[model samples]
Target: MDKIINSPYNINAVARVDSDNIVHNHIYHYCPIGRVDDNNFIYDNNNNVVGRVDDDGIVHNHSINNSPIGKVLENGFVIKENALVGRVDGDNLLLAGAAYLLLIQGNR
Candidate 1:
Protein backbone atom coordinates (compact mmCIF):
# COMPACT_ATOMS: atom_id res chain seq x y z
CA MET A 1 0.00 0.00 0.00
CA ASP A 2 1.10 3.58 -0.62
CA LYS A 3 2.16 5.53 2.43
CA ILE A 4 0.28 8.71 3.32
CA ILE A 5 2.31 11.63 4.70
CA ASN A 6 0.75 14.52 6.60
CA SER A 7 2.19 17.96 7.32
CA PRO A 8 2.81 18.72 10.97
CA TYR A 9 1.27 22.17 10.59
CA ASN A 10 -1.95 20.83 9.08
CA ILE A 11 -3.47 17.39 8.72
CA ASN A 12 -6.04 18.28 6.03
CA ALA A 13 -3.58 20.27 3.93
CA VAL A 14 -0.77 18.81 1.83
CA ALA A 15 2.54 20.15 0.61
CA ARG A 16 3.19 19.99 -3.12
CA VAL A 17 6.11 21.02 -5.28
CA ASP A 18 5.46 22.65 -8.63
CA SER A 19 8.60 21.41 -10.35
CA ASP A 20 10.87 18.51 -9.47
CA ASN A 21 13.60 20.79 -8.10
CA ILE A 22 12.17 24.23 -8.57
CA VAL A 23 9.18 25.79 -6.89
CA HIS A 24 7.72 24.14 -3.77
CA ASN A 25 4.29 25.20 -2.58
CA HIS A 26 2.33 24.01 0.46
CA ILE A 27 -1.48 23.94 0.30
CA TYR A 28 -3.48 23.51 3.48
CA HIS A 29 -6.91 24.28 4.91
CA TYR A 30 -5.78 27.04 7.27
CA CYS A 31 -2.54 29.01 7.46
CA PRO A 32 -0.07 27.62 10.00
CA ILE A 33 0.59 30.12 12.73
CA GLY A 34 3.50 30.37 15.17
CA ARG A 35 7.14 29.57 14.47
CA VAL A 36 8.69 26.29 13.22
CA ASP A 37 10.65 24.77 16.05
CA ASP A 38 13.58 22.71 14.71
CA ASN A 39 12.64 19.77 16.90
CA ASN A 40 9.15 19.75 15.42
CA PHE A 41 10.31 19.96 11.82
CA ILE A 42 11.82 16.54 11.39
CA TYR A 43 11.32 14.69 8.08
CA ASP A 44 11.27 11.04 7.11
CA ASN A 45 12.90 9.24 4.21
CA ASN A 46 9.63 9.66 2.29
CA ASN A 47 9.93 13.43 2.77
CA ASN A 48 7.24 13.61 5.43
CA VAL A 49 7.22 16.57 7.82
CA VAL A 50 7.60 15.12 11.32
CA GLY A 51 8.54 18.32 13.13
CA ARG A 52 8.90 22.09 12.80
CA VAL A 53 11.57 24.86 13.01
CA ASP A 54 11.07 27.75 15.35
CA ASP A 55 12.29 31.35 14.96
CA ASP A 56 15.49 30.36 16.69
CA GLY A 57 17.74 27.52 15.43
CA ILE A 58 16.61 24.94 17.97
CA VAL A 59 15.36 21.44 17.20
CA HIS A 60 13.02 20.71 20.10
CA ASN A 61 9.71 19.78 18.46
CA HIS A 62 9.28 16.32 16.98
CA SER A 63 8.75 15.67 13.25
CA ILE A 64 9.59 13.10 10.61
CA ASN A 65 13.24 13.52 9.55
CA ASN A 66 15.99 15.45 11.28
CA SER A 67 17.61 16.75 8.13
CA PRO A 68 18.97 20.22 8.58
CA ILE A 69 16.26 22.61 7.44
CA GLY A 70 16.89 26.08 6.05
CA LYS A 71 20.39 27.11 4.98
CA VAL A 72 22.96 24.38 5.53
CA LEU A 73 25.90 26.66 4.88
CA GLU A 74 26.36 30.40 4.45
CA ASN A 75 28.02 31.76 1.31
CA GLY A 76 29.71 28.38 0.93
CA PHE A 77 29.23 25.55 -1.51
CA VAL A 78 27.55 22.20 -0.80
CA ILE A 79 29.99 19.47 -1.65
CA LYS A 80 28.76 15.91 -1.81
CA GLU A 81 31.82 14.24 -3.37
CA ASN A 82 35.32 15.27 -4.39
CA ALA A 83 34.41 17.74 -7.14
CA LEU A 84 33.74 21.40 -7.81
CA VAL A 85 30.47 22.35 -6.18
CA GLY A 86 28.33 25.32 -6.99
CA ARG A 87 28.77 28.45 -4.92
CA VAL A 88 26.00 29.68 -2.63
CA ASP A 89 27.02 33.32 -2.80
CA GLY A 90 23.55 34.47 -3.80
CA ASP A 91 19.97 33.84 -2.71
CA ASN A 92 19.44 30.83 -4.91
CA LEU A 93 19.67 27.11 -4.14
CA LEU A 94 22.13 25.50 -6.50
CA LEU A 95 21.58 21.83 -7.34
CA ALA A 96 24.72 21.22 -9.37
CA GLY A 97 26.61 18.17 -8.21
CA ALA A 98 29.97 19.22 -9.66
CA ALA A 99 29.46 22.85 -8.77
CA TYR A 100 28.67 22.01 -5.16
CA LEU A 101 31.68 19.68 -5.12
CA LEU A 102 33.96 22.51 -6.21
CA LEU A 103 32.74 24.86 -3.48
CA ILE A 104 34.02 22.68 -0.66
CA GLN A 105 37.21 21.56 -2.36
CA GLY A 106 39.77 23.25 -0.10
CA ASN A 107 37.48 23.95 2.82
CA ARG A 108 38.23 20.55 4.33
Candidate 2:
Protein backbone atom coordinates (compact mmCIF):
# COMPACT_ATOMS: atom_id res chain seq x y z
CA MET A 1 0.00 0.00 0.00
CA ASP A 2 1.33 3.42 -1.02
CA LYS A 3 -0.02 6.70 0.30
CA ILE A 4 0.27 9.97 -1.55
CA ILE A 5 -1.00 13.27 -0.32
CA ASN A 6 -1.95 15.02 -3.47
CA SER A 7 -3.27 18.25 -1.96
CA PRO A 8 -4.08 19.85 1.33
CA TYR A 9 -7.73 19.04 0.88
CA ASN A 10 -7.41 15.56 -0.60
CA ILE A 11 -5.31 12.43 -0.25
CA ASN A 12 -4.75 9.96 -3.03
CA ALA A 13 -3.80 6.45 -1.92
CA VAL A 14 -3.15 3.32 -3.90
CA ALA A 15 -2.69 -0.36 -3.12
CA ARG A 16 -1.34 -2.90 -5.56
CA VAL A 17 -2.45 -6.49 -5.92
CA ASP A 18 0.14 -9.19 -5.54
CA SER A 19 -1.33 -11.60 -8.02
CA ASP A 20 -2.46 -9.37 -10.85
CA ASN A 21 -0.31 -6.68 -12.42
CA ILE A 22 -3.27 -4.66 -13.63
CA VAL A 23 -5.11 -5.09 -10.35
CA HIS A 24 -4.95 -2.11 -8.04
CA ASN A 25 -7.11 -0.10 -5.71
CA HIS A 26 -7.14 3.66 -5.49
CA ILE A 27 -8.67 5.62 -2.67
CA TYR A 28 -9.51 9.30 -2.67
CA HIS A 29 -10.05 10.90 0.67
CA TYR A 30 -11.50 14.38 0.82
CA CYS A 31 -11.03 17.01 3.55
CA PRO A 32 -8.36 15.10 5.44
CA ILE A 33 -6.68 18.24 6.70
CA GLY A 34 -8.73 19.20 9.75
CA ARG A 35 -12.14 17.77 10.19
CA VAL A 36 -12.70 14.01 10.33
CA ASP A 37 -15.64 14.40 7.99
CA ASP A 38 -13.93 12.68 5.11
CA ASN A 39 -15.29 10.61 2.26
CA ASN A 40 -13.69 7.58 0.65
CA PHE A 41 -13.84 6.83 -3.04
CA ILE A 42 -12.68 3.33 -3.90
CA TYR A 43 -11.58 2.04 -7.27
CA ASP A 44 -11.39 -1.52 -8.50
CA ASN A 45 -8.42 -3.45 -9.91
CA ASN A 46 -9.25 -2.05 -13.32
CA ASN A 47 -8.72 1.50 -12.06
CA ASN A 48 -12.43 2.14 -12.06
CA VAL A 49 -14.08 3.70 -9.03
CA VAL A 50 -16.62 1.07 -8.12
CA GLY A 51 -17.84 2.51 -4.86
CA ARG A 52 -17.82 5.53 -2.60
CA VAL A 53 -18.49 6.32 1.02
CA ASP A 54 -20.13 9.67 1.43
CA ASP A 55 -19.59 12.18 4.22
CA ASP A 56 -22.81 10.96 5.78
CA GLY A 57 -21.33 7.48 6.09
CA ILE A 58 -23.41 6.04 3.32
CA VAL A 59 -21.86 3.50 1.02
CA HIS A 60 -22.75 3.79 -2.63
CA ASN A 61 -21.73 0.93 -4.87
CA HIS A 62 -21.59 0.35 -8.60
CA SER A 63 -24.24 -1.62 -10.35
CA ILE A 64 -21.91 -3.25 -12.81
CA ASN A 65 -18.18 -2.56 -13.06
CA ASN A 66 -18.05 1.11 -12.10
CA SER A 67 -21.64 1.82 -12.99
CA PRO A 68 -23.56 4.07 -10.62
CA ILE A 69 -25.77 2.10 -8.28
CA GLY A 70 -27.07 4.91 -6.09
CA LYS A 71 -26.08 7.79 -3.88
CA VAL A 72 -26.75 8.73 -0.27
CA LEU A 73 -28.16 12.16 0.26
CA GLU A 74 -27.31 14.36 3.22
CA ASN A 75 -30.52 13.30 4.87
CA GLY A 76 -30.73 9.88 6.49
CA PHE A 77 -32.11 7.74 3.74
CA VAL A 78 -30.80 4.43 2.52
CA ILE A 79 -31.73 4.37 -1.13
CA LYS A 80 -31.56 0.71 -1.92
CA GLU A 81 -30.26 -0.83 -5.13
CA ASN A 82 -32.35 -0.61 -8.33
CA ALA A 83 -34.80 1.79 -6.79
CA LEU A 84 -35.76 5.15 -8.28
CA VAL A 85 -34.70 7.41 -5.48
CA GLY A 86 -33.93 11.08 -5.16
CA ARG A 87 -33.94 14.04 -2.86
CA VAL A 88 -35.96 17.21 -2.44
CA ASP A 89 -35.21 20.02 -0.02
CA GLY A 90 -32.65 17.96 1.82
CA ASP A 91 -35.01 15.04 1.99
CA ASN A 92 -34.34 11.79 0.18
CA LEU A 93 -37.24 9.72 -1.04
CA LEU A 94 -38.37 7.31 -3.71
CA LEU A 95 -39.47 8.84 -7.04
CA ALA A 96 -42.56 6.62 -7.25
CA GLY A 97 -41.60 5.65 -10.80
CA ALA A 98 -43.66 8.54 -12.19
CA ALA A 99 -42.09 11.75 -10.98
CA TYR A 100 -38.47 12.80 -11.15
CA LEU A 101 -37.17 12.78 -7.63
CA LEU A 102 -34.54 15.37 -6.97
CA LEU A 103 -31.45 13.86 -5.42
CA ILE A 104 -30.08 17.14 -4.21
CA GLN A 105 -32.48 20.01 -4.04
CA GLY A 106 -30.65 23.28 -4.12
CA ASN A 107 -31.63 26.01 -1.75
CA ARG A 108 -33.94 27.92 -4.04
Best lDDT among the predictions, by candidate number: 2
> RMSD in angstroms, candidate 1?
14.8
Write model 1 residue lDDT over 1-108, tens digit each, in one string. Answer: 111122223333132212222112133222221221123333333454444333332222233244432322333333333332233332322222112122222333
lDDT of each residue in 1-108, candidate 2, tens digit only: 222211112332222222211222223222221111113445433454445545453444443454444544444233446442332221222211101011111111
Q: State model 1's lDDT.
A: 0.27
Candidates' lDDT values, in order? 0.27, 0.29
Each prediction's TM-score versus the true structure: 0.20, 0.26
In Å, residue 39's CA in model 1 sits off its true spot by: 9.1
